[model samples]
Target: MPVNLPEIESMELYPVAGVKLGWAQGHIKKANRKDVLVIELCEGASVAGVFTLNRFCAAPVTLCRQHLAGNKGIRALVVNTGCANAGTGEQGMLDAKKTCNAVAELLAIPQDAVLPFSTGVILENLPMDRLLAALPNAVNNLAEDNWKDAAYSIMTTDVAPKAVSEQLNIAGKQVVVTGISKGAGMIHPNMATMLGYLATDAGIEQSLLTEITKEIADLSFNCISVDGDTSTNDSFIIIASGQSEVQFNSREQAGFAELYQSLLASAQKLAQAIVRDGEGATKFMSVNVHGAKTMAEAKAVGFAIGKSPLVKTAFFASDPNLGRILAAIGYAARECDSLNDLDTNLIDLYLGDVLVADKGGLAKSYKEADGQNIMNRAEIDMTVKLNRGDVDVTIWTCDFSYEYVRINADYRS
Candidate 1:
């Protein structure tokens, strides 16, 4: 039941100058526990965000995008679970704006400073009064060091909460990066069904924050998969409090570039944790596609393999169904010179070196005992070498099981 990834530390030790962590109970479909969270950032802090690309994205995303475009920096974040403010049409938009206004009023900040996000059943009108009632208590509980609690409060069907932090030394000052995210199903990112919040104590320019956020997202959230279903609500935001006082001007080329790379690594670590905890996931999987003519082609092959039902189901079965892997690649790939040209004899499909599949077909060596042993592990890696060209890409996914179906099918009930 334990996760196999490295233990991700929390960044609570850092001094966050202008942020408060708070949560409110109730307002959920099965209310009884805290489901609303509020993060109040200090005035003049820079904010950057990434959202789902689904055409039917939630009302909150549209509003957030509009605000960000206007360059109206945020000072507050209001998040809720149990009622995704989506698909309710114009009414949902009004409710979302009203929710933000309420939080702004409570915190005495501008409405544009309040960014709102929601998760859970779509098409239901948000319970504004219930959520508003809990805001005072949530604000009262706000603390400088509650990253773990903030991560846990946003869960819907997730089995465990996800949070990560890292400290990097730059120009003699330690920059702290802390992040938390929630995702279990309806995942397969054009960014997925999830919300991620990243906070940093280091001082960085808004332009740099914008660039780093976009680049980091391409490698992390954009490269994960679960059930291949994109949601109407997916959001990730980063807040730079500038508490570290480590300023980086565009002129400081070397130092700034290095610092930006480190930030991306920290963000990527938090994103992978969400995929590892994917619903009904017995094993966390990584799919690598190499030898493509272009990055687009490589990503296409990666996602095709990652989202394949046959490949995922075979993974759940631990059957080492290499044929399914090849099938997915063949179907999703843009161009491959010859399927038969692949070196089937030298191919090694290993379940921890068990060699369940060889070359282009199932290993005559596939055994039930050996397969079951591999399936028992909490994490799995599926690697395919095209041996065609030089391009490469990797993506994360979890096994598909009946539990996954049950969770999503009855998600609203």
Candidate 2:
């Protein structure tokens, strides 16, 4: 069980006005499981996305990019779990296209207007026959309030279905944002191990949608880690259906700022949920790096700490191993070529509220029990002050455990 991660007791996902979703038990990997999802977007909907930086990205990712670039105005999305359709070369590409074709044909939309996504084992071909056969069931079941089912359908190793919804009044019209994401292992920044879908009814230009999607992805999905491995199928997509009467000409528009904030908050919650439910995760950890010379440097430091297996295990053991954190920060500074100008003597570190290290060394009044007490909790906050400049960043992560090793070792079996 994930530590401090609550089971979403009630499905309260609000319906985005111009979006509808459905799922089917394609049995792509497991029997009688909802392994496929279909999202139907109304005409005039604008969409944008950011995908994994991994050169070995999945076939569906390639198709998604190509289709998006064509500017046909995406009207549908097909997602499958069980076979990632990654590392399958040309056949994988063909399989992805076929799936898109099936969805497009079923919905009577142009083939280029469909985007596809997949997750699961790598280097295997998707069960295309079964997947294609399930398309009609998904289309037949489409409904505006199917967000929760869509969330469940996209899971691979996720312990919980992550979903979030928010609504705001824009120019007297109610606009809604609802999103879902899934990830557990093979997770890290540079686009963590996840597939995220966020949709809103507020209207925005397609170009602006593309720009803000990348921006929101940076502030959300790109700021989390689980096992330090960026998956090949990582993707985050945002859509604007324009069902509401409100439209924004620019970021300066009265309601744009509020809508953007709500969107970011929803994305952040979904991202954090992935870390909270990380494979074998027993504690949710937040690493905050402050007073850095640049945001990149701050993020580097936070990831260095967040991705350190030694640091994660120490937290798992409830051990106050402050030295491990210092080592990680030093290594990050060196790796990012910030060490020469980084003044260790000006650094300060805290585990929760206890100052474990000050001026780059042990705090004179620090106590081991104090750090241990904080580490023993299901949630932890680590604060590091570089005292270099004004930039800051926070990265979410989880503690490693024996179960994590076991889960991955037996993953293919």
Candidate 3:
């Protein structure tokens, strides 16, 4: 049973003001599918981004970071799904630059304005010629209304393309925020292996666009986890073209808040869609941790519990294994030295209140039926109370199953 979000399907994307959208099916990988996507940014539009924090990040991530940091208005973003352009050392950097150069030449934009992103097997060299050959076709197919096709073109293991759009009212006029993302596995906090492209038709300052992007991504991509593994090449970019006449004043305008909230909502909507389509996931789980000493402690505990293999397996088995849940909490709290006697003993597991575990041991009142019923739901909410402070946070995760292994084992093929 697929959980359908109406907001996703009912999303209305306003045509980008000056940007012409396009994509290509470059045979950069062996998938024989459309392995490349291109989104040509309007000249002088502000660009902001967030990239993976992995120390061994891919060449494209490194290059994109530098390109975004330079802060000059960008003209285009070119992406491929066959090679991550990572772990190839100097040659990889050269290849990334070459890919950008090729895109710049074909689009008649400067190479510096072109950003490159690659996702696929790491350590393998990219098939530059195959990717290059598809550029002319992609350019010729550029259209503002083909975002859905562009979204699908960049997918690898994703069963379906992920995208979302939202309408916001600014100064009594409607503004649009449209976005697309790609990710299936190797997803976790600290920047998962996801690539997202967000476009808005509202007019705003470059610095303000950068601020909104960092803020929204922190609340969206940085808060979700699928497998607890960060990929080498993960990046997200947002482009804002003042195509709409709605001008936002960073200091005086209250409409900016509404617009930013809309953008964050759209980003989170896409992020959850990625989790729903997670490889081998049957149930989407969200853990909310409250009453901790601080938000940091809350997140630490939440991610620890969310990423626990035992908890994930319990979810797969559809068993409310309270012990595994409590154990994960203890270990995670120990890392932060936040556990106290009350914190240790006050914790209780309610297999719907059968008291499956209490005070760090199995409860005699535990029942198998209660556990089974809780796991039956497609959406499971796990709550953890620290009993120490009011600080709290939430995290998203998915159940692990045998199919996950099957998918990853043959992922490269």
lDDT of 1 at 370: 77
What's the TM for model 3?
A: 0.92
Relative to the true structure, candidate 1 reaches a TM of 0.89
Report lDDT (Cα) of residue 333, candidate 1: 36
User: Residue 313 lDDT in model 2?
Assistant: 96
Q: Which residue pairs does candidate 3 place in steric collision?
A: 350-353
| By lDDT: ranked, best first | 2, 3, 1
Give candidate 2's total backbone clashes: 0
Query: Which of the numbered candidates is closest to the native, going by highest lDDT?
Result: 2
**Model 2 lDDT on a 0 to 1 scale:** 0.91
Q: What stretches of model 3 exceed 4 Å from their correct place?
A: 1-12, 249-252, 334-342, 348-368
Error of 2 at 112 (Å): 0.6
lDDT winner between 1 and 2, please give it. Answer: 2
RMSD of 3: 2.6
- TM-score against truth, every candidate: 0.89, 0.98, 0.92
Estimate, for each residue in 1-413, the C-alpha lDDT of model 2 and write its tens digit.
Answer: 86666565334788999899999999999999999999999999999999999999999999999999999799999999999999999999999989988898899999999999999999999988899888889999999988888989999888888888887877788899899999999999779989999999988899988988998999999999999999999999999999888887688888888988988999999999999989999999999999998888998899999999999999999988889999998889655776557888999999999998989889999999898899899999999999989999899999999999998998878
Q: Judging by TM-score, tell me the better candidate of 1 and 2.
A: 2
